[model samples]
Target: MGAACIRERLDRALCSHPWIDRFPDTLVKHFTDQGSDHRGLLLSDKAYTRNSRPLFRFDARWADNPEVRAMVNYVWKEEIQGTPMFRLWERLKRLRHLLYDWSRAGTTNSLRNIKTLQAEIERIKLVHPVDWDEVRNLEFELNRQWEAEEIYKQLKSRVRWLKKGDQNSSYFHTVTRARRKRNFVAGLRSDNGDWVTEELGKADIATNFYQCLFTSETHVPNMAERVDNLPISQSITP
Candidate 1:
């Protein structure tokens, strides 16, 4: 038999029923062939736990609540005995924890709230009396939720051309998902010339690299002499 080069969609990923059941949210991605004739496939589970803690992001929607402003004012007014920079840093750290705690309890799932409010409004309309007041109240809440959802997606998408809360939630969502996929780091190459695919391994590699980079092993005994030795074309005399 002789080998022939031809373009065809012959490569595919196959999985057993048990495997699918175990990783229900698994996503398969295709990569272009580098040295081989066939494309490479990567499988990732969306629900897999991440090794590193997620970074905190401020949600602009939180500003809409009057209580959030009051909370910030209270945190800033707290007394802390320290140098100017140290006091500012401590206050910011405390404010971050305070806001995080408040946000966890104060924030509602906007999409879920929107759906629930919509359902309730529909139910209210179905009533024989059609309680107009109740429907109006529900509608108002639904609109607020919709705005929150829009602001969230807008922030994620980083798209500012279109004004947020203009009912372009779907567009923003699609852009956000695309950006996330583009920015995702599936794997990394370690300093030991090894591929690190697991999140923990990649994190370790990054941590070690940065630790070595920023940690100074040698101490300078004569810092003033070293600075004075540098050639200077011009000097300022006071």
Candidate 2:
């Protein structure tokens, strides 16, 4: 069929379909070419899919606990004392980095070295299998270390912001949103299989605060309600 006739047909179909709103976003078009013998029509629609899974979050409040602090210190000392497993891991890490550098430099020798190291590691694993429980413990320890580092960084950043005497409300709001997003993503996978998106609750809280702050009303009907139980102050009475 001619390009003009195909276009007209698609236009008519779009007009006739009042229930198009129910359907996903889509488009129909005719393609005419100088080289090709025939004209073609294409229809496209968007596919909806679930979001990626969120990572775990460490409890920052745990840092304040004496027992947790002691455990973290003990772990650090043990790591410093370097077991045979730690040596092996360090070697493996160095070898991997070397291979990466070589690959980026486009060197065949580096590529060969990476393959050799990988094969050797696999062979060792096959010969003497590592304990799954030990692996899990190590992974958990690594995650804890990373979380501690992040907490330190965030605290430092907050301190710096405070020292600068910058009372930018937007900055505080951004940090608050980030914390909420992280919390929501963390609570996603509980004991049950259901996915819980915490943003719904946080959104309500945020919206109320935003309206209270921005609205022109001189008296925002007990501003304490808008702050969501945050400890601001009680009162200044002589």
Candidate 3:
């Protein structure tokens, strides 16, 4: 039987049947159809066997823990060192590697290690208690560093894609446009009353910018219209 059907049957049998005490963790055995033209039976300890297959495991409870959030925050704080802004950029690289390993192993060893360190700090607090505030501050700083690192990595990935001429897709174009708009706005602001010479020249730049914007708007719609108007047979094959 198919895997889902097998699981459903097994679930019913397990709940109702008294003979079947426990299900084996491993597969029973592979069976072939014989000349009798009948499906092979799956032999288990309990009842008559039928064709069976392995079921995929799903564990949802592990993802919903508050401790997971606390652990992540703690690990992030432990990684931060100097100026939060600059340190975030550097720490992001390290965080990315740790995250990859966490995914592959399906565990958070790095976060767990940080928790152990935090526990040690707590123990020291019991003895002296003077540096407790300092310890807490350091932890907060580390978490901020990790947060900044994550933001930097996400922005870096988007920037890399933009640099690679990957704006053909609608989603890519949308992201590129937003990034460009944000950077342009940020560059235009000045601390003093006087504007930068480059900023003053934006009037000249606006003409070319608007021209390109209009061209893109016109072309994208025309391309979409053309695609929509094409014969279905020409776009698809039997």
Candidate 4:
């Protein structure tokens, strides 16, 4: 149970049902101000299913590393036995696999990696004069991870206003969740008075409505002559 007290006495509390655990539910729900001492619980059971969407993308930042470019050059120099297009596609596919593995190499538990790097830096500073080369490497790794995270957030949120390295991870997370909630269609009432609670049903109902509206048989009445008769701001000679 959690609560925010509006009264001076702190007498109010918010709680979940005793049987809430029996069902898969949490008490971390919002409430409305009903002008009462106690906050009324908002029991929300809205389930928003997000489909797995892994996009095939090449990180342009990988081009910044000379080692990566060298690898690409080597791959291109290799003569693969295939049609020109097929050979190119195969080589690119192989490069994509290599880059994906490289990208994932240090990205797992990035926070832990950041902390570890920070600790190492601190330890080095205390033990000896800071190794600037090691520090730079650590900073580079952190920046790369941050860029990777930003790319993920940008794709997931669909909001392009925010730029990378603005310390807006929290903002991106909030925006992404809000977008998911906004996109969720809990239910829709169909023309036949049937409630479409299923995902496919809701989609069909919305699709048909828009399709019908666009393909409407209603003719638009001509109002060009009526507009011409209306009083004009400029003096008309005719």
Candidate 5:
């Protein structure tokens, strides 16, 4: 019966933690309490799951598309009434969204249609290759789709040693799976000296370790000190 705009907005995802006030990972479901004026909050007892962030990389295939080039050129050259930095930032933001939209609209549908066309070609061939021209046309379409697929797979696998359009989608898939498996840590030791299997805990440990390792510390050796400490003898100096 009570009106709360923030409460209404956050009904699905409760930002406040169930136990501790921490970084947002909370979700809630509200239900009517029997004989009560206020709705009861049901806190999720399960561990919070982290959403996978999107990875955006440039696809070489898109470069060949005249339309894609025109789109990029148009967006890049759009005049914004602002200071140089502001204009650049706004343009970059727009470009990011544009590229994301473009990528989402890529070869998936074309490849799917190729499969359907392949089935149709097979059926027509069995019936007596009367649709020879149709088959040839579909083959051309398949070739185009394959090219896009190859470019996509190559970008994903980073295996540029092989020539393009070699029908290496399976190889690229295997490489990607293996890379993910190799990079994934099932568990990691936390600062508390316990094995933490939680994704958030492991991520925090890794982030902290790398940040500390890369950060400039209070006590550190400079390039001169590093040179002096080298194992090479003064007699063997170049």
Candidate 6:
């Protein structure tokens, strides 16, 4: 930061074999210093763009809603033209779309509602003649929404050992945030030694890598030859 500070260089990129295999095209670019004494280094790759669908996760909070159950029942009853397994898959696929739409239209945003209710309650209390009835009603609604928010956090945190009665919403929130941060893949090295930071590039890299990894490169062995080579008597036993 200053001349008095001993001059030293420690900036470097460290990656393992698995990481290199995943993104062989990883490239590092250096940039001129803007304000800091140290210059900036960016890992990047050839830009790529593609449309991707968001992943669907069934919210546990939906379990408490009767409408969700009814929707699922209605979807499950539909006779789809397919094998048993295919029919089940089709039913689930249809149900997911319906549930997604229902969830989008439903009052799922408890946190915002909780804050609004709290503000309204505070405002009512400031009146010269306190409206106890209104305050009580708002307080009840606030608690209900707060509980729903807590349940949402609890499900996200995935703390199986923690009981629902133990209302540690803040703890659950912290755990959920930490898990998401740890699990998130910010960037990936491509085969060309460039970092794939864009969502589309990263997705392509991962998909290609796994596809190659799982694909059978060797030709299928002859079953008859393998059976004849078995460590057993060829003639019938006496």
Worst 10 residues of 2 by lDDT: 9-18
Clashing pairs for model 2 are none
- Candidate 5 regions exceeding 4 Å error are 1-53, 82-86, 105-110, 120-132, 168-170, 181-238
lDDT tens per residue, model 6, 90-157: 68869999988877875778878887899999999999899999899999888888778767776889
- Estimate TM-scores for all models: 0.54, 0.19, 0.24, 0.41, 0.47, 0.51
lDDT of 4 at 58: 67
User: Number of clashes in every candidate structure?
Assistant: 0, 0, 5, 0, 0, 14
lDDT of 5 by residue, 1-238 (tens): 3565343332343232223334223335568656854676776545455454444556677777787787779888898876565566667668777878876874445567668878877887887537788878878877887777777777767788758557646767767655543454557998889988776677779768765554424365598988889987757746
Give candidate 3's whole-model lDDT. 0.44
What is candidate 2's lDDT per residue for 1-238, written digit by digit as tens?
Answer: 6765543332212322323434434444457645765457676555433354332233453446565455545444443334455544444444444434433453323224445545554554565566556555545544444444444444523534343223344444455444443333223433345544465543445445544544433553777687878655877679
lDDT of 3 by residue, 118-199 (tens): 7766776778546877778757754644443333333533644333222234444445444433343212323344443353
lDDT of each: 0.74, 0.45, 0.44, 0.63, 0.66, 0.74
How does residue 89 of candidate 2 score in lDDT? 48
Q: What is the lDDT of residue 127 in candidate 5?
A: 79
lDDT of 5: 0.66
In candidate 2, stretches whose alpha carbon ends up further than 4 angstroms from where it belongs are 1-53, 56-61, 73-159, 163-171, 175-238
Give the better candidate number (1 or 5) by lDDT: 1
lDDT for model 1 comes to 0.74
Once superposed on the true structure, which residue ranges of model 6 sit more than 4 Å away at CA?
A: 1-53, 120-138, 161-171, 185-238
RMSD of each: 11.2, 25.0, 25.5, 14.2, 17.3, 13.6
- Model 4 residue runs over 4 Å out of place are 1-56, 107-113, 128-159, 174-238
Number of colliding residue pairs in model 2? 0
